[model samples]
Target: MYFWFLLIVKSVFHHITPVPKIALPTAQGFSFIALTDILYFKADNNEALVYYLKPYDTKTHSAVIFKRLSDIEAALHYNGFLRIRRNYLINTYNIKQVNNRAIVMANDETLYPSRDRGKVVEAYLKEHFYI
Candidate 1:
């Protein structure tokens, strides 16, 4: 019984540990983006544009990185980021409103959620609101 309790406690502690930060390369050097700060990732050809949330700013700042949106989506999915479209991976925490099939982000950007992913987004919103 003690061994089982110890194992469960260890598992909980492991899950609560902080995830590794993502390093984004820039012209100057690199920027470390925490999972909580990411607003969304937009695919632009072979590059992915990362938008980050900033306090006291109405708009989010963006940076282009040489990575695929799918790749970023996979890496950040466990951190509350969801791929709502083929070209968009958005942080669920930054969602402001849901208008029909579209989502309004905290930065006031309107993005269309994919038809197949609409239900998923709705469920997430419901869970977020504890409704």
Candidate 2:
């Protein structure tokens, strides 16, 4: 069968040929300047950094550019991340604890799930915020 032939070829090539290095030449990794996807840049002098938002790219083997942190918050809110506070957007998958007063993200980071939302954070976490 064609499938068997292809498999044999692949196996032969994989064993005989040196492992071909496949990598995204740095341009594709998460950048602080563009943290939405695969670009990361940070300003050494500035107190507040301007991060770019991108998503992952399968073809490029990198996260794709989405938008800025603010933009991401506006879009993915309650869907992929929990807005623990104005500055911290905790991926619910990263959450380790929750109580009446606060939600704990990894690295011992804790944030009050904005009491104004009442049970919105808890409810959203229950529905979305996957691991």
lDDT of candidates 1 onward, in order:
0.84, 0.46
Model 1 Cα shift for residue 48 (angstroms): 0.5
TM-score of each: 0.75, 0.42
* Candidate 2 wrong stretches, greater than 4 Å: 1-69, 75-79, 129-131
What does the lDDT come to for candidate 2?
0.46
Tens-digit lDDT string for candidate 1 (86-121):
888999878888887888888888999888988887
Please report how far candidate 2 places residue 118 from its true position, in Å: 3.7
Best TM-score among the predictions, by candidate number: 1
